[model samples]
Target: MLIFTSVTWLDLCLASAAVYLVKQLSGKKNPAPYPPGPPGWPLVGNIADIPHNKAWLTLAKWGKKYGDILHVKVPGRHIIVLNSVKAAMELLDKKSSIYSDRPVFAMGGELVGWKDGLAFLSYGDRFRYYRKNIHRVIGSRTAVNVYEPSEEIEVRRFLKRVFAQPEQLDAHIRHTAGAIILRISYGYEVKDNNDPFVDLVGRAMHQFSQANDPSAFMVNIMPWLANVPEWFPGAGFKSLAREWRQTLKETVDAPYKFAKDQIGAGIAPMSYISNLLKGRTLSAEEDHMVKWSALSLYAGGADTTVSTIYSIFLAMTLYPDVQKKAQAEIDAVVGTDRLPSFADRDSLPYIEALVKESLRWNVVAPTGIVHCVSEDDIYDGYYIPKGSMIMPNIWSMLNDPQTYANPSQFNPERFLDNDGRGPEREPRTISFGFGRRICPGMSTHRSIHLADASIWISAVMSLAVFDISKIVENGVEQTPEVDFSSGLVRRTLSHPEPFKCSIKPRSAKAIELIQQDVNY
Candidate 1:
């Protein structure tokens, strides 16, 4: 032992350096060229190039320079942004077997345990099981149609909440969304004030956004830091991750327990979980999938309709003429005697187009779900390496000037005024997002089929009753800017930065209808 080490410290350092160099050199030898992007620095590799907030805008601008497929490298990861629908569809949709896997986020996915949810599940049997469980419940248009009556009833409650507290429009929207998802996912109805389930979802979603923020945790930036033990110096993130993980687990478990209790008493309503658990003895695997599959509906898809519902109010407030047009269409088709239901959905073309516009205006999951490639391949002559994160920039694709006329304008007519060109591209194919909820990661689309009925009903009923006008303060009309979260930090959903609009009933009849008690 004493005769052992001939190597000095410098020699050991040099040996490690040589090994790193060899690996780097081998990795650099790509089979084909990488898609064009702003040149990254030698060591940092585009660390300064990407914006933390509103990164999609910067990526879209890069698309103009780099073509549809743009590549950017960070310290230890390669990222590819699919800026066109064709490219996204070709890679993430068509060749999905390789492109559908997920890259685990250090904070949300792994440490906080969101990886157990469908949104972050890797492309494998668990992922398929989660998808299978969800599909049987709300996969198709017809399947989602089963929820139509509940949708109408809850939107009607939303109307009552809005009519009662117009100033708290955002809260009411979140409340209604939570109410609907709870009833559908578990058969448990939410309490109007301080509902524990609703609060749990809100906390979980807030943590989800916090996890997306690079500043919230250093581990998000230097993922290797995740390996540091809890007792290590300045490893406070471990404690925080543990706290957040408990919240996520409660979010998954608490509601699930409620659903099971209801089933045991034989008083459970037909719901995603109830249907899965009723009169059947599920294996341990089936039981695990059922709980998370229910969460996929709650913590995942809960905000799906919340974001689009805001689109309706914002659209109406900014463009009163468009609101008037939509109201007139609803009035003409459904009349004012009663609230509009899904039965009237087919007859109200303008209201239907309004749903499309709302989705298009503020992309629900703007940056899109990030997909991981399992193997190396060349796409359109560019080398797409394995483990590259493929983010379909839904914002870029939806807002492309060529695909959308007046891309910035909030006009529902874009879908209607296609000049016989088949009503433009359907926003649903893109708007529901190419993958699952919270922070975007590789997964299947939560899909427009779930949000469609809610958005349309909310829009139709809101317009039919309430006139959403610009808020007036001190006798001066104030226009709410089209903004979400002040662009100060990163965000997962495009929730509007707090804004005010004057929401008032259109008539005495409207007031009466809004005040009317909604039946289950």
Candidate 2:
């Protein structure tokens, strides 16, 4: 009996040793190799160090410590942050073929129905189809021509609102920009802030931002947890996921139904939905495509553009000299006798500089959308494994001390030439994004920004006089220090943050031109 027991024990020991050998061999076969970063704890990884508010600011500091290509591990995931323009361009742009795919999130894609959205769609035929359709409506010269009338009307309306109630400048910026995109994309107008369509889109966008957050759901990191039945009372995340999915579906479908109703009644205007629906039948895939595309436009066009305009206002108030220079250029070129038009953009160099500077100073999407690697690749002799998530750290790139002297200072002169000509400034760092994932809205955004900035500078001479120094805290007045918060997008950190300034017409001619020329 003792001999038999010894033989059985030996067999068990041999089985355990073989298992260990296999695991070691497998690990060696698929070794994870990327740049160096602080070691992460088991399970949670480096999630605790990721700042919820100012993530980019923290990321920039980390970049300073660990070179440009830093590896970050998040339980079962690998994130590579490209901190410089050179690295971003090399990996994201030059090797875009394998870098265009976005990381898959079960909640955002499967539950929230983002699989069809152009921004989140995987690189494939469906994505190609969506891009082709988008380009047809908003990409090329023909689309720009088609959008001209609406753009003009909206800008005029924006100026009129600014002239009538300067206090509501923020709301005006939101409305004018939102309305034009709405009109052009869906043949709808934002009649008021309370508009259901506008409110629904806003709510949906907020939810999307939250859902996209890595920490928003544990199931995102450990998706197997989702398999637990929703009826189980203790399934905390399951319940929340259900609610988010429901809200997303409603938000996405509401505008879609409106578009469909309009199409069915033959009242369909020459908008994106109408154009696409003209010759196409709604297949299941196409339905997904349409809904997601609509959601993308509503969310992407509204939030980021509005945030940029807000930053512009904040910058103008904080940096009076920058505002003064922009106004001076507008006055000299277009004069106070006429409203600035797209054609005058070439001549108004200073206004152009101010726009570029505003974008740089307080970047809208600071960390930028994440990109995923499709295959294993090498960069500078470092192994970038397949399926590593890429973060183009825009904050680091934009604030590179070597590229922009006094990087923290809000100076438009950095982008301008000595002759006062706004030279085409190449990004010493990547801000928008890299490669094929570069913002398709670049041209559209440039035109809108230039037109809006020029008008604001010309009409509101007091923009230069606005003082952001006064802060009211606990019913007491004091001067507030300039501070900003970081996130996927950066926002002004300090509050009671109202700028105090008197806005007056730059000239009598300016008032007359604004009052007469503005069609709204």
Candidate 3:
């Protein structure tokens, strides 16, 4: 009986091999040929070369070495990086129907329940519905209306915070942006940066960022390991995934619950969650959907906005000439008597240029959410296979020497015409992403940045005055040029390790205006 059983097992294994071979032979050939990339090792592919931080920058360097489009193999995954605007437009825009899907990740999808998150959801009916709803709420027209009051209040608050404690400008800027989004989404104002909601959101973002780190899970490379039981001793990732899931659930559902309770008591303020909850019964699936949407707003809006503001500050500190030019424009247009507003945006051309340049200098969403091909497509004689992951390398495009001279320089003039008008309706960098996945918060983001930047430069006469250049260790100046954190969303540029700077009122008039506006 033992001999018979051994022979049967061997026969089954042989049959399975034969079936797999037959299936491979019967499968259709990849219609379009993939682009060339660095020679990858078997099984692991190029995974070894990819760093946890600044993966996009590394990929962009590889793109320059291997031409505009490069194909990379990461275990079971096939990734295509479109390093040029033309290729990105061809794949992610022109052929969006076959290229709008997102790649499936075991942890992000099944474990964390991100299958329904608009940023990660596949291209399907549900994704379409979510996108449509997001558009209706935060799209262009609505974004303008939604931004008006928030921008006014937050810019004033930010100025007051800076005037009070210039040293805490970084934290204050972060809080101001977070408060705006929190109020918009949940009708909950973050009165203090230490508010539980703020801490919870910050912790949740850190958890998500860590979880999404390339090396966070081996399952991203070999997904079969995801099925390992959490009770198993070696299942380290299983515990981490569970913790991440819990964090996400709390961060997402807490605000939702708060809104629901407020609505039940007929005391809910007009906010995104309140609007979503009105006249809608919460089915299990609907509840999950609503929570994900609200969480997206919170997470997406807060980090990116704060990062951009930091970048703006860094740019001003690094390029004093540019800062002077922008301040001159602000002084000429809005003057220092009062803070700048959205209505003054058109008049302050240089400030708009500064805003655009800051976004292009170091995009917050560098690689953006990965794009998956829904079907086989051909572009520029290269075959892009169905199910392949496509990345529009925004870093490469923003730094393309062909488009912008001295690409690394933080010069806002690149985005302005000789006459000081903004770049015409041509393509800018893909900071907001591409095609259907373009950020729904684009208008709101732009408006906020414009208004805030204008107010900042107009209110503060000299960023040089607060310059920490005098306080330095080892002969290094504390400047924005030296401070930058790595990763898709880098921190401030050229940030001095630790330095002190002073903030004094540019004028008594500016101070009085800020105080009155603080109460406004």
Top candidate (lDDT)? 1
After TM-score superposition, the amount by which residue 231's alpha carbon in candidate 2 deviates from its true location, in angstroms, is 2.1
Best-matching candidate per TM-score? 1
- Candidate 1: list runs displaced more than 4 Å: 1-22, 25-28, 212-215, 417-421, 435-448, 485-489
Off by over 4 Å in 2: 1-26, 29-32, 163-165, 264-266, 279-284, 419-429, 443-481, 486-520
lDDT of each: 0.79, 0.65, 0.66
Clashing pairs in model 1, backbone N/Cα/C closer than 3 A: none
lDDT of 1 by residue, 280-344 (tens): 99999889888987887676667767777886788788999998999899889888899888888
Residue 175, candidate 1: alpha-carbon lDDT: 89
How do the predictions measure up, each by TM-score?
A: 0.92, 0.83, 0.85
> What are the RMSD figures for all models against the true structure?
5.7, 8.2, 6.5
Q: Could you tell me the lDDT of residue 462 within candidate 2? A: 29
By the lDDT metric, which is better: model 1 or model 3? 1
Q: Which whole-number lDDT from 0 to 100 does residue 17 have in model 2?
A: 54
Clashing pairs in 2: 53-486, 54-486, 93-435
